[model samples]
Structure formats: structure tokens, C-alpha cells
Target: MNSALGSRQAAAAVVLLFSYNGLVIGAYAASIPSLTARFGLAPWQLSTLFVCMGLAAIASMQVSGRLSDRIGARRVSLAMIPILVAAILTIGLAPSLPMLFVAGILLGLGNGGIDVAMNAIGVQVEQHRPKPIMSFFHGMWSVGNLAGASMLVLLAPLFAPDPQPAVATTTSVAAVLGVVAFVVAWRITPETAVVTHTDSSGTRTPIPASAYLLGLMAIGFGLGEGTANDWSGLHVTQIAGVDPTTGALGYTCVVGFMVVIRLLGDQLVARFGRRAVTVFGGACSGVGYLVTALGSGLPVLLVGWSLVGLGIGMIAPQVYAVAGHTAGGRGLAVVVTFGYATFLISPALIGSLVATLGIQKTMFVPALLLFGLVFAARIMPGREDDVAPSAEAEASWTEPA
Candidate 1:
């Protein structure tokens, strides 16, 4: 009874942590217009900021992943939460472009560290559960995105005249949420079971080739997602002729569909299997992106955006889940790093294209990228019944001191 109770509590903690992380990201996305205005940043300049953040985040993910392997994900997560909160505050208060750049780096570091640790912990939770629930955790992330975006939309009128107050208020809210997330994280179990393999000579075997294949798929999906996250609002406002608040609604639509689809992803994966889901999802996203690029009106464009959300919603969580099941923290790090590298680069690529071709035509870039997932879907983890326990899966859970 105690074990079951403990499991539920731990699962809840991880979910909350994921939600908080998503909230921070969503708020940042919602604040982009204000940030651009305040800093007088061009599209390329905004992409440059994303590049800085992405580089820092990549470094942090590598270090955090290695450290989590040695000390456990829970500890690393706990240690980084404070840093994350501080960075959020710093970003909100930054008065100049250079200061904002520095804050972006700090935010990226905090976000990357916590992201790896929590995902590692989430993998541990999935291992103990009866059903595949990783998608649901990510679904909660989409929910947080909705909540954060909605908050900004509501607060938009109040802060329209001043960008500083808007940023400060939103980030302050994130900091408070960060505190709550920290408490929840503290309640989760501290130790996660590590997965490893040994060969005939007793030497540890390399991570399975499938993990790398999944990483490639992740990169493709990340491109789609990163483009939507960084550019969706601008596309809607500038191209579709919507107000700034309504422009944010375009991203809200994307996340809204993502939340609904991801919440149901586990059941869909269980019923149809990963290959079918990945292929079909990719096709849907491709079609959706084409619609967004060619659609004449705001309503049509929003529908296309929503379809895109549904299509790619399951890709990242499933990839992370597969990596976690196969190689534990180390595997997750490698795959996530590969995936995030593409995500980070997406803004720069799209920004350059937007400069030349305009935002509407730039949608083709991610549309074409989505199709790559169809060929790569076959490499995803097979059905649960087909998977066998590895030497690392057999390792006993070591409780934290």
C-alpha cells in the first residue's frame, strides 16, 4: 500500500514539474512580441537570441545528463529549480538587449538542466506503471502551455503600453510556480534505475542503434515544433492580419490540439503501435503545414496549425520514452541533445528564410521536414510485448540517502 501511494505521489510530482517547465516556455513564446518591440529586434536578431539560448541549453543538457547518471535525476532537478527561478526573474527584469542576451543564456542553462533531470525521472515513473503514460506527462506540458499563453492574453490589455511590466509580471508568476514545482519535485523518489548491457567478454555494450534512429526522428519533429513555437505568432499577425493578442491565439491553437492529442496518445500507440502512429502523424502534420502556408484566411490557417499540432504531438515524448527504457539517463541525453540541436537551429533557419521569402512561404521548410518522420518511424521502439528486460532493467532501485 505504501509503495503504491509513493508511486502515485512521485508521478504527480513529475507531472507538476513538466507542467511548470512548459509554463515557462509558453510564457516566453507569448512574450516574444513585447520583447521584439522593447529591444527593437529584427527577425534575424530574435533568431540570434534563440541561438544563444539554445547553445547554452545544449551545454547544460550534456552536463546535467551526465551528472544525473551519477547522482540521480531528482537531486539534479532540485538543485536546478532555484537557478531556473532566478533566471526567469533576470529575464523579466533585463533593461537592455545585452542584458536580455545574458538572461537568455541563464534561462537556457536552467531550463536545459531541469529538462533532462525531470525527463529522466519521468522515465523511472513509466517503468513502474502498468500502462505507457509518458505521452500524458507531455500532455500536461501542453496544458501548461495553454495556461501560460492564456494568462498573457488576458494580461495583454493591461500591459500593452509597457513591455517591462508585462515581462516582470509574467516571469514573477513563473517564479512562484517554480517554487511550487520545487516542493512537488522534493516529494518524488530520489533514485532512478539505470539501464545498461554487457557482452560475452563482460564489457558494457554500446547503446542500441535504435536509439540513434529515434534521435534522428526527434530532430525532424523538433524542427516542426520549433518553427511553430518561434514563428507562429508572427505569421498570424503579419501575414494573416490579426491583432497581436489574436496572433498569440494562433500558437494557443497549436498547443490546444497538442494537449488533446497527447492526452490520448498512449491509448493510440497501444492500439495501433508506434510505426503507424508516427507515419500517420507525420503525414497529418505535412498536410497541415501546407494548408497553413496556402490558406487565405485566419480561420483556415488556425485549423491548419491545429492539425499540425495533432500530428507532431506524440513524437518527442515517445522518443524520450524509448530512449529512457533502453539506455536510462545516458541514452536520453544523447537523443534529446540531438533533437534539441535541431530545435535550436530551427529559428535561425526560419528567420533567414523569412527575411528572403516572407513568413508564409517559410512554412514550407517545416512542412517538408515533417515527411522525414515517415521513413524514420520504423526505427521507433516496438510493441511493449516485444521488449525484454536488459541487465540494467534488472538492477534494483537504490533509494536515496
Candidate 2:
């Protein structure tokens, strides 16, 4: 193991931190409507805000990756998580538009920093584990997402009528949880040796081809997820001729199955192997999206989305694990950046395509992307390749990023 804690203990802490990040993201998502109403944000403004957050997160990932490689992931995480917590609180309480924008940037930076640093830590811990555990860690992220959204849903009703009060209350609760998680994360950080590199010839190493290939896989998964986040509900609504509230249940099915698949992803990967599992997941998603785009009934839509969730859920953890193995923090950063970019661009890309091709046809885009995963998944590591590579292994990396 990497830090002061044993592998098992470190895995627990990593799970907690992953959940914490997910909670923040879920709370932020759940509060979006309220935030929109409170600020009277125009659609363009909302888009701009997301763009800013995404750009900042990208920058944060790059910086955090290099820093983690240089110093240590535990140290980087200690600094980043607190910033995320503070940013969350600031966002919840921002009094002006300018302040909200500033808070958004910090929120992105903090969240991104935590993502890179903690993932590095997770990779460190995974290196020493007896069996595959990355999926479980990532699964807890889904659990946190469910918990965060549920918190707002259950609590918001108590403060109903004004959206602001409900959002403020939820954010406050999330912040408290964030504080608790930050401490736990530190105490349980894994104790494996950190990966550090210095070129005696004064040359920087280029990222390997395998890492970039995995990044492309990340993009495929990212777009599939982003589509579900924004369009699944709307798509089902139009198809089933139902209200938004009823249509939302379709996407709920997606998320529910997503959480389930991720929770079980480890065993699946272990039994079927990573490459097999990924390719299977890709096929499932591709067929599921096709069913969704062509289906006319609510029941069918639900099944389609369930498949979509199940398939997409299997991807991220595997890719993250593979990327980490490929090049440690730098590779993880690359994959994370590629994956997260979908969140920012997928909506706009789909929306524009919807204008020309219609929503049903546009749904096929992600299906196509998901299908790409079938072949792209060849880059995933085999079960026997779980451990971090040695110096000799590092020297053999010649693939271009």
C-alpha cells in the first residue's frame, strides 16, 4: 500500500472520498433548477456557466496530476477536498452574479483537483489489493449520487414553495457531510509507494498510445452518460406522450440500473475479464440506445434506459483503472479530462443535431459512440495486469498520447 493506511483501510477512505465528490456533483445537479430560478439565469447564461466550470476543471486536472506525481496524491487530496467543500458552501450562499461565477470556477477547480488526486491515491491502493476493487470504489460514487439527490428530494418538500430555501438547506447538509468525509479520507489514505519520474537526459516523456486510446474510450462512455443526463427523460416523454414528472421515472430507471451495475462491476470484471466486460457493455448500450430511439412505449423506454445505464456504468471504473496502470496520475488525468469533456459538449452537440436530425435520430449518435467502445475497449488491461508497472515497464512506453 501508498500512504499511512493499509490497502483495505485506504480503499475504504477512497470509497468515502469518491462518494463525497459524487454527493457534491449530485447536489449541484439537483439544485440547478433552483439556482436557475433564484438567479433568473437565461439559457445562454446557464450554458456559459457550465462551460466555465468545465474549463476550470480541465485545468485543475492537469495541475493536480503533475503535482500528485511530484509530491503525493494524499497531500494533493488534503488540499483539494477542503477547497471543494468551501466552494460548495460559497456557491450555495453566493449573493451576487459575480460571486456565483467565482464560486463556480472554484467549485470546478476544487472538484477537479480532488478527482485527479484521489484517483491517483485510489490507483496506489489498487496496486496492493488482493483482487479488483476499483469498481466498488467507483460504485460508491453512484451511491453518493443517489443519496445526494434523494436528500434534496426528501428535504426540499419540507421547505417547499420557494426553491431557494430548499436548495440552501440541501447544500448546507452536503457541506457538513463533506467536512466529515475530508477527515476520514486523510486518515485512511493508502500507503503504497508513489510513482515519480525524472529524466536524467533532461527530456520529458510523452504519454503512451494506450493511454490516449483509453481516453477515446472515455469519450465514448462520457457522451453516452451525458446524453442520458440531459435527454433520456425528454426522449422518453416525447415517445411515451407523458408529463415531465412521469418521463423522469425513465431516467430514474437508468440511474438505478447504473448504480447496480457499478456495484457489481468488480465481480463481472473479475469473472469475465476487463476487456470482455467492456466490449459486452458497449454492445448492450448500443442495442439499448437503438431500442430507445426506436421504441414507442414507456415500458420499452424504461428497459432501454436501464440497459443504457447498465452498460455505461461498467465503463468508467475499468478505464480509470487501466489508465492509471498505463501511466499513473498523468494517464488518469488524460482519461478523466476526456470523460468529463463530454459533460460540457454533449448537450450542445446533441441539441444542434436535434435541430437537423430530430431527437430520435440524434439518440443514435450516442449509440454509435457506444458501439465504438466495442472495438476501442481493446486497450483495457487484462486481469493479470492489475499491478502498477515497474521502472523497466515504464521505459517501454512509446505510445503517443
Candidate 3:
């Protein structure tokens, strides 16, 4: 065993930080309507505004991954804290859509930076542990979302007097949470950076093929996540005839269930191999979307979301773990950061799909994609093989991104 706290502590730190990030995102989502009303923007216009955040996140992931590898996760994480706090504050103080867009970009960049840095750290920590801990760490992100959403919902009354006032209040609270999380990250992360080294050539090495595969896998997983983020409410409203408040319940239930399952995922993955877990998880997710598409009423809708949560719980972490093991575990921070960037595209794609197809029917697309994931899981390499080149290596990977 690795001593007191060990890898688990590192994992917890990453998860907690991620949860704080989630809270900011949740508050932003909850406040979107207010933003639209305040600016008198159409749904499409609001979406366009939000796209800057996603794009910035994706770009930052790619840039930050390499930067973290060159510097260290500790520095990158510490530096990102102020950016996150600043971005949140900007959102609270924005006077125009353009200013909000700038804030969104900053927020996305900060979010991407934190995400990649944390995953890199989590990947490092998981390496020494007895269990597969990545899934659980990633799952904690869901827990953060739950906390964030709950906070927004609870604070709804604080802004009930006016849309702008409510949004400002929520944004202010989120900014404070971001600051607190930054302080926690700064305190826990060592000041002197821990650099991962390779034995050959006595020089730091770059991430290898598997790192890119993790990124591709992220693309698939992101698609699934995006589906939930963008469409769950649509299903509830259109199919279940629920009010927006009740429709929001669909996302809440799915995210809540996902968080719980992910929190316990390390134990589950330790008990069962990643391959088996992913296969079954993909099946469950497919079923969940199928249920959402065809099943009637709230009970079915909630079940669909729960199943989706359970299914996706382990997938993201598995990808992160694979990124860590590649290239003798060198450049892991970069791998995770870049791979995550690719995955962030899913939500926008889901939005486009929903626009093209009716929302309820579009929900089925995720199920179909998950069915593909079942096959993808089959092709995924085991933990050891993912790192070492072997005669048994079957999974194809792209050159380092």
C-alpha cells in the first residue's frame, strides 16, 4: 500500500476541484433563461453565445495539456484557479452579450485547463493504487454537478424578483464557490511541481498512441454526455408533457444517479475488469436512451436517465486511465488535456442533431451511438497493454495529438 492518504487523497483533491467547476457550470445553465430574457435573445442566439465557452474549453484543453506536460499539473492547476475565479466574476458582472461571450470563453478555457490538469493528476495517482480509481474520480464530477444544480435550484428564490437579479445572484454565488475551490486546489497542490520522468534517454518523453485513442474514446463518451445535457429535458417536456420545472427534473435525476454510481465506480471496476464494465455500461446507456425515446410518463423518463447515468459512469474514467498508462506514463497530463478537448464536442453535435430531428426522436441517437460503444469497448486495450507495446496489442491508436 502507498502510505497514508496515498493516491486516494490525490484523487479526492481532483474530484473536489472538478465538483467546484461543475457548480459554476450548473449555475450558468440554470441562469441561461435569465440571460436570454435579460438580453432578449432567441434560443439559437443564446446557444451561439454558449458555443464560445465550449470552443474555448476545447482549445484550452489542447494547449494546456502540452503546457502542463512542459511545466507541471501543479503549476497549471494553480494558475487556472485565478482564471476560473475571474471568469465567474466576469459572468456575474457582464453588461452585454459580447462581454458575456468573453466571460464564457474565459470560463471554458479555465474549465478545460482544470479538467485536463486534474485528469492528468488522477491518472498519476491511480497508477499506484490497488483499485481502478479513475472512474470514481471522474464520477465525482457528477456529484459536483448535483451540488451545483441543487445550489442553483435553492437560490432560485433569491432571484425570483427579476431575471437579471436572479442571474446576478446565482453568478455571484458561483464566483465565490470558484474562489473557494481555487484556494483548496492551491493549498493541496504542492508548490514544487512533480515531473513524470522516463528511464530511457534520461529525458521526458511524449505520450504515445494510446493517448490519442483515449481522446477518440472521449469523443464518443462526450457524445453520450452531450446527449444527456442537451436533450433530457426535451424528452420530458415533449414526451412526458411535463412543465419546464419537471422537465429539468430529468437532467437532475440522471446527473444525480450518475454521480452516485461514479462515486462508487472504483470499487466496481476493481471487482470487474474495465472491459466487462464498459460493455455492460454501454448496453445500459443504450437501453436508457431507448427508454427515454419510447417509454411513457415520468417513471420511464427517470429510469432512462438513471440507466444513462449508470452506463456512462465508468466510461470517462476508463479513458482517462488509458491516457495515463500510455508512453510509460509520461506526458499523461497532455494526453488527458487533449483527449478531453476532443470529447467536449459532443454537446454541440447533440444540439445540431436535435435541431435537425425532433428532440424526443433525437434522444435515440445516443442509444445507437452507445451500441457502437459496445463494440468500441471490445476493442479497448487492458490497463497494462494500453501502456506497453506487445504482441497482443490490438487497439489502433493515432499518433500523439
Candidate 4:
């Protein structure tokens, strides 16, 4: 029971760190339009910069997740703080288009690496904790998103009179906050980490190919999230005829709703198993997109975006929960990282699809995927405790952590 308590504490710490990370990442996104206008880059050129960030993040996911097992998430996460702070600072100082792109790459790598380590350790910590904790833990990301976006939104006007002022102000404040969160969260991690092992009898396990299914699920959710993150604001402005500043409110609404939903998500999942939750959740997301694509007026856009938030709220966390149950030891981390990699890839892929089709139409791509994911939800293995030892034996086959 103490071990379980420790695990929950560990997971909570991971969530705090990521909440800070989310704040920093979200600030960067809000600042992008400013960055684009300041640099005078075309829309396609700006999109390419985001693609660079995605590719860098995807590349680092596996490396960081595997590194966590050997050195520990605490150490890797601690080391990442300085790099992240430095990246954010550099972003503020970026004076050229090329420099901004470079910042994106560095920021993406740091964000990805920290994400993998924290999630890997988080699930391991949740193993001993009572009830479904992963959803709440993952929900912290949304909390971070809310905090980060709120910070940007509040500061947006203050910086608004001038682009230079907005960029510098938002980035600097965000960097300081990020550093403080990292330091505090790092201090809370257990000194004697439980260290995950794959085999019940052995010390380590490798993530199986079957776990790619988890990544596939992630690709679906990632699309929804990516659409929200990248396109919600655009959708409001273009479709609902809102002012650019007011348009961002749509994303703000989504982020705020997601944060609340995720905070309460554990209770929801406990009441309804992951299978039912995921399928219905996907349907909710599909409806959200469909509404945004089809509906007119501010009220309709807000409603659609809000539904989008609710739908995706549990999807990513469930993937982590399933990975934790299916893969043991550091294998959990590896599988989570693989999912992050998909997260990295899907947005750009979706963006290209959007470019080819159009943003409003392109969203249907992820919506369709999530629509299909409703059916795929059945493939996710059942509860960790339900599997018999024979099942465990099959699950425990050869793999290095």
C-alpha cells in the first residue's frame, strides 16, 4: 500500500512537471502568429516550421523514453529543465526566420524527451496506486494547457500594442515559470524509484509489436488534439466570422473544458470501462468536428469546440493506461514514447491533408480516424488484474526493458 501511495505521488509529480511543460509549449503556440508576422513568412512557410518541430519531437521520443530506465526519469527530467528554459529564452531572442525554426527544433526535442520520461515513470508509479490514476495524471497536461493558454491570453493584449513586447514578455515569464515548476517537481520524486520490470520474474521487458495498436489509437486522438490546438482558433475566425482575437477564445474554451473534464476523468472511467468510454468519446469528438465544420455562429462554434475537448479528454490517457497494463517495466515507457511519436507525426500529416483539402475539411481526417477508433477500442486488452497467470505468461515473453 505504501508502494502504491509512493507511485501515486510519483505520478502526481510527473503531472506537475508536465503541467509546467504544457504552459511553456502552449505559450509558444500562441506566440506563433506573432512570430510569423514578425518574420513575414508565408502561411506555408510558417507551417513548415511547425513540421520541423514535429519531426524533432518524433525523433527524440524513443531516445528519451529508453534513457529513463537507465538513468531514471528524475535525472533526465531534471536535466531537461535547463535545456527547456534555454530553448524558451532563445525563442524570445530569435531575430530571424531561420533562428525561429532552429528554436522550434530545440524546443520540440526537449518537450518530447521530457514527455516520454515523465509518462514512462508516471504509469509505473500508478501501478501501486488505488483505482484508475492515469487519466487524472494525463489530465494534468490539460491543466497545464489551461494554465499556459490562460497566461498567453491574458498577456496577449498587454503585448498586443507591440509584437516585440508580446513575444518577449510571454516567453520570458513562461521560461521563469517553467524553471520553477521543474525544480519543485524534481524535488518531489522518490529517491528510491521503483524501477519498472517487464517480467514478473525478470528485471526488464520490451514493448511488443502488438502495442503498436496503442500508437495507432494515439494517432487518432492526436489528430483531434492537433486539430484543436492548431485549427480551433482558425475555425472560429473563418467559419463563425469572429475577430482574430475573439477567435482564439474558441481554443480557450476547449482547453478550459478539457481541463475540467480531465480533472474529473478518473471517476468517469471508473464508472464506465475504457472500452465504452473510448468509443463514445470518439463519437463525441466526431460530433465536435462535424459541428465546427458545418455549424455557423459563435454559440455553435463554442459548443462544438467544447464537445471536441470532452471527446479527446480521456483518449490519450487511456492509451497510457492500456500500455502500462500490457507492457511492464520500462516497456511501459517505450510504448508511451511510441505513442508520443505518433502524436508528433499525425499533426503534420493532418496539416498536409488540410493543406491539400482545406482546414475545415481536413479535420474530418482525424474525426474519421477517431470515428473508426470507436470500433478498435475493443482490441485494447482488459484490466491488468483480470489476466490469468497464463495470460501474464504470454504477455511476459522475451523483451529487454
- For this target, which candidate reaches the highest TM-score against the unseen true structure? 2
Alpha carbon lDDT of residue 104, candidate 3? Answer: 83
Q: Write the per-residue lDDT of candidate 3 for residues 227-342, one digit (tens) a residue.
A: 78667877787788879988888877777777777888777677776667777888888899899988888888889988997887767777666655453223344454444554
lDDT of 1 by residue, 1-401 (tens): 11331377777877887888888877877777888888899987987888889889889988887677667777787888888787777777787889888888888898888888888888777766666677888899878877776777777779777766877798889888888778766765445543335555667667667667877888888999988877877788887788998888778788778888899998977787656777888888888899989986888888888888889896777778777766666677778888889877776688899999989998988888888787777666566521222443412234444
TM-scores for every candidate against the unseen true structure: 0.85, 0.94, 0.83, 0.82
List ranges where model 4 is wrong by over 4 Å: 1-12, 95-99, 191-206, 236-250, 290-302, 328-363, 385-401
Write candidate 2's Cα lDDT for 1-401 as tens digits: 33443346677778888889899888888888888889999999988898999999999999988777766677888788878787778778889888888889988999899898888777767766666777888889888877877888888779878777777778888889888887777676654345544355746677777788888998999999989988999998898999999999878988888888888888887787778888988999888999998998999998999999999888888888877776778888898999888778888898999889988888899999999999888656665665455443332222111
Q: What's the candidate order when arranged by decreasing lDDT?
A: 2, 1, 4, 3
TM-score: model 2 vs. ground truth? 0.94
Show pairs that collide, candidate 3.
Answer: 159-166
Question: Against the correct fold, how does model 3 do in TM-score?
Answer: 0.83
Q: Which of candidates 2 and 3 reaches a greater TM-score?
A: 2
**TM-score for predicted model 4 compared with the true structure:** 0.82
Clashes (N, CA, C under 3 Å) per candidate: 0, 9, 1, 3
Candidate 4 lDDT tens digits, 328-391: 3344545555555566566668768777987777767767888888877777765443211125
Cα error of candidate 4 at position 379, Å: 1.5
- CA lDDT for candidate 1: 0.77
Candidate 1 lDDT at 231 equals 81
List per-prediction Cα lDDT, in the order shown: 0.77, 0.81, 0.68, 0.70
